[model samples]
Target: MLKEKVALITGSTSGIGLATAHVLAQQGINLVLHGLVSATEGQALANDFIAQYGINAIFDDADLQDVASIERLITKAISTMGSVDILVNNAGIQHTQSAESFPLEKWNAIIAINLSAAFHAIQFALPAMKRQGWGRIINVASVHGLVGSVNKSAYCAAKHGLVGLTKVLALECAEQGITVNAICPGWVDTPLINDQISAIAKQQDSSFEQAKYQLVTAKQPLPEMMAPAQIGEFILFLCSDSAKSITGAALPMDGAWTAQ
Candidate 1:
């Protein structure tokens, strides 16, 4: 059922979204890669998928902060790929600050892109999905969604909202053959986590490797950060036929962080 299907993964130029795109492309899924990249760069990345995986590919430079842009993104994907059979809401931004110290602009941006964009994308994507009687929507939430930390009010709020949205959508679309779920991952080995590790290093006067170890072990019992490819593979499983009954779950691949 996944083969030849079109997936629109926001933030597909980097991090987990890119990893997921690669895995899906390997499964013969056509892709609409969305991110902030120049036309040439985006096309180059898309063409790479075509050359390497032999799947149809295109890119949409949609600004997820704007609801109108989110709708346009879905429309553009449908027009370009016939329909986005899989929609991955992976575009996100983060700001590290206490609630009182958080910048208003950062708070707004985090909410818009990290939370509202998924809602807008689902709102737009559901029509075509309902018409076709099959769709997969995966929201890339975080362990923070299931738990919380200091100085991360905006991030926590947005991710928590995403998880709630996933549950509601899943219930509403249960019989529509549209599954909605959130993947709550712990410290995945992405550039974002690398930046956090660097910040920890600078603050604690530790080496990069030490910071990485400390960061992962702080919240996780497993003592290892997860790879982006692992999340990608998990997403692939969620999109597969065997996982058809796994809707409405906020599944945690968090190395037992939330279990603690």
Candidate 2:
């Protein structure tokens, strides 16, 4: 049922979002890719998908922080691809600091991109989804949404909010043939977390591998870090007919992190 359907994924230029795009494209889904990359780079990635998957693809660098730009993004996707059958709200930013010392600007930016952008994207995409009587809305939330960590107040807050939003939207669209859910993944071996691992390595005077082990083992019962493709595969499963009944869930792919 997903073949030839259009999916719009935000923050899709790299990391988990990019992995999800690849999974969807491979399923014969047309794509509306969004990222912060330059237009040329974004278009090249879209072209690559088209060439490799023989699927339609387009790229847009919409500013998620701006409501107008996000609206335009959804509008353009619908106009170009007919409808956004899958909406992945994966764009996010993080700033770590004590709650007391967190910069207001950083807090606002995080909330805007990580949380509010998802809200706006959902609002704009729901109409098209409702019209078709089917949609898959996946929010790439984090384990932080279910639990918490020090120096990650804003990130936790936004992720928690996203999970809550997932539930509400799911209920609202449940009978309407839309499944809204969040994927709460633990550490995925993505470039987005590379700097953090490197910093841990420096602080502990250890190798990157050693630091990565320490980091993952600290919270996850399973020390192995997840791969971006694993999350992509999970998402693909959620988009299938078998998963049509699994809605309003913040499913954790987090090595049992929150299990403790």
Name the best candidate (by TM-score).
2
Q: What TM-scores do the predictions have?
A: 0.97, 0.98
The TM-score, computed over Cα atoms with residue i paired to residue i, of candidate 2 is 0.98
Judge candidate 1 at residue 227 and give its lDDT: 85
Off-target runs (Cα >4 Å) in candidate 2 are none
Error of 1 at 59 (Å): 0.4
The digit string of per-residue lDDT tens for model 2 on 5-34 reads 998999999999999999988899999999
How much lDDT does each candidate structure score?
Answer: 0.93, 0.94
Runs of candidate 1 exceeding 4 Å displacement: 202-205
For residue 158, what is the lDDT in candidate 1? 98
lDDT of 2: 0.94
